[model samples]
Target: MSFGPPPSLYTQSSVAADQRRRKRRRTVLLCAVAAVVAPALAVGAWLWWPGTASDDAKPTAAPAQHRLDVRETVERRPASTQGVMAVRLSTDDLPPGEAHEMPGLWATDKILAKGINRTLVGVAIGTDAGLGEEAWKLRLGGPICGKTRHVTVENRTAVLFRDSADKESLCNHVAFVDLDDGKLVWQAEFPVSGYVDKPDAGSQWDPGVTLTHATVTVTWGDGTDAYDMDRGKLRWRVTSREDCISQGAGGGRALAVRFRCYDADDPQSRSTFEIRALDPRTGRSRWTYTPAVGVKDVRIISTTPTVLATSAGDVGITEIISLDARGKYRTTIPLQGGAYVAECTDEITYLATEECPSLAVGAGQVFLTSKEQGDLIHNANWIIGFDLKTGHSVKKFESGPNTLLRPLRMSGDRLLALRESSDRISPMALVSLNPRTGAETPYFYFSLPQEGELFSTTEFADTVVQNGRLFFGAKEAQGPADADSKAWVWLAFGIESAAAKKP
Candidate 1:
């Protein structure tokens, strides 16, 4: 079944697995010894960066151990709404010409890395501590076709790119890049045949790549291959059956593949989509789960819990399916009406893993944001968590009438949400929500220049909350409308410091 487009310029959310686990563990430990966290402050007068008191706040290189301990820092003064290090990236030094589609964005304790399309080729660019300066750059041979949000403990991740600068070159090359050193550790190329350019006919069959702790798996046209994460040596290979085609693979703590099989008698008449779990170290199938017969799209939410967002006969995601470790169906949460929005985009067709932008799964619950209730002046929203095994709404965090809450990332047992800047009267803030107590603690507050505010949304840019800072980077940058005119395209911007200033 064809969902829509591939994971191209519009793919929304992605996070490295290693980074998440480390932060989760650190957050849990920090909360145990920290003092009681304070509540958020009242909304302050709209204030922009630079040329104001907020300008005095500067970005500093955070200590290594404090990277994931953002909760502890906020507890000292949780209600602060003052700005700190407000770094805005107007445009980088990359040769300016036509617009470029910037694909991936990842962050570490010391640097923030972004994917750039430099003249049709893929270039990985890094900045030191949100300074907006290029610390290093790695030029992939061609435009990045796909990438895995999972990173190894040593800060290594994989990316998929084309073989040459030719626009028609298929994305058949995969490489592992070291984020800390900004170096390409290893790369390998696989050949794919009988490729189709149409979604319905199987353009989603393009080679896809994903990373696990010990393995990097890629799906060629007909089958799948698993390689060692450190070295590019092939660990195991699985060829597809004569009547089946492997769509792609997704990985985290475990690996899973989604493919379809056709009837031997009539290839066009029969179709069945299946998802199978494979051991990361070896290529053995552990369990398989098949959705209802006509489920058109299936996106992997989390591999460990085996959650999937599926659309049956309808267009967008109609429900969320939870499965047990043994592949047994646990529960199905129906989303037929417009009460809740998971933000699953149709453009994420190929390697459709990790595509649910507005949903977070953890602590035996799947958290989702409720639909907005009001208009521009008084927008209302809330985040509700549902038990994965019982499909019951267990927790709810409201976004007061002035702001809307969007889940950014999960920290330990808490969920980090972006409190959207409602209007010129209010500023955007970050808060951590507790599933157990329903308590929300404010992290920091900052506002973008009037012109730079639009890019702050997750749809227009990529977001990263690290080292007690929140960053928003453009997903794509277009050149000047003409040669003589300039465009207000922001490459990236970040907010730090949560210490409230005297009102």
Candidate 2:
């Protein structure tokens, strides 16, 4: 989606250029200072001390203090759920054309970064009483094909995009971007053999990327490559075998690959799936786990805990499998009989192998949302937690009628849930769910714009919480279904407050 900034905001390109110029000036000044001090430092002299003063007489500079951002302070003193709109981005800002798929959402202390159509954009996260403005934009050469939901501790992430704008172009380019300043730190292209025109064709698979603390992994159907996150240098490569095709990879605390193999000579033989864990640095196999004969598809829920979602005869996910750190089977939570909702795929497109947005695995529990229960007038769901060891339901958090709760991610040890807006009346909320008691503590509550109805359901949207705010955005931005009808579509929005001060 092409987004135009509001009247109150500056264009991202201009702001980014100005920031770059200032950074260059600072670099030059620092270099000049070092040059001036070079000769004095070679004399074995204490430059800052008085004549003949001993080395021990020199005073040591104090260490820099660490300052907390707005988001950090909010965590210390829980932000009021009663929040006002901080920023609202709408698709209506630009002329409507073909629908665009938006994929990635991330936040830093001062800005919220998102992948919109082909461009990565950042907007200021305004205070409780103001609206955030556009900060910067980094335009990729082509639409983003895949991205890593994992952000490094220093706030860096990776993205995969095509070499050109042509729809049939191969998604061969991978890059690491600095989320803080919207800068492309490094980018490199990989050899890809496939067809973007036919993603379902046997030749098409890769086009995926994932991140660990030190490595950025990218897969393009036929092979997988790992790169140094800082320098974009290739660390290792794994190619597909004649019988087993490399699907893709997932990474966070650990790295794993999904593969499919079949007997080419036996036409009636069934194809099998395998999950293989790899050493993030060297691409060496750590262990491999094979599912039941009938399991058709497998997805990674968490690499640290080694949790997976698998599908059998049906199209939807059938089981949630949890494995130990050593890849041993620990438990299987069944989803049959419509008892739970852990969908890994949608009608339009397949999510990344590890991008099960609604499901969370942490704190010795695999948390999932129960299927919505109620009639048209009222509907609700439960955030159910299943023990990773026993596969038994242990904790549950319920929502009120007309309200739905979905797990976003784990915050420290607590699971964070999004309390979706209800019937256009009750405002949406961000709540912290206690892992032990299933009790909730509100982080904040805020409503979206009328054009933001698309965010009501996060199934197809990306939701991220950082600092102390919640950012919810649409994955698909399109015009009204009917060409003749007119409807304002919102691209994304943010909720935050400066009013919640430390008590």
Q: Model 1, range 110-207, lDDT digits (tens) per residue?
A: 55567776211211222112113356678888877776655565666778887786545667788888776688888898757443544322343666
Model 1 CA deviation exceeding 4 Å by range: 1-81, 86-88, 92-97, 118-133, 195-204, 264-267, 345-350, 498-503
lDDT score of model 1? 0.64
Q: After superposition, how far is residue 430 of candidate 2 from its true place, in Å?
A: 0.8
lDDT of 2: 0.67
Give the clashing pairs for model 1. none
lDDT of 2 by residue, 1-503 (tens): 11122211111111112446545633443233222112212321211111111111112222232221001112322433355445555422323245677778887777677787678887765421111235778889887877867787677888888778764566778878988889998999987655344453234555678887588888766677899877899999988776676776778777998887778677468889889999988999899999989998889888888999988866788899989888999888998666898866352333388888779987789999998888644778888889999999888888777778899877666777787755655556677777775556666555543444456566657787776677777777665443333334556666654354321
After the best TM-score superposition of candidate 2, give how far the Cα of residue 273 lies from its true spot, in angstroms: 1.0
Q: How does residue 117 of candidate 1 score in lDDT?
A: 62
Q: Clashes in model 2: which pairs?
A: 71-467, 71-468, 81-444, 81-445, 206-220, 206-221
Report the number of the highest-lDDT candidate.
2
- Give per-model TM-scores: 0.78, 0.79
Model 2 spans with C-alpha error above 4 angstroms: 1-79, 91-93, 127-133, 194-203, 266-269, 345-351, 480-488, 498-503
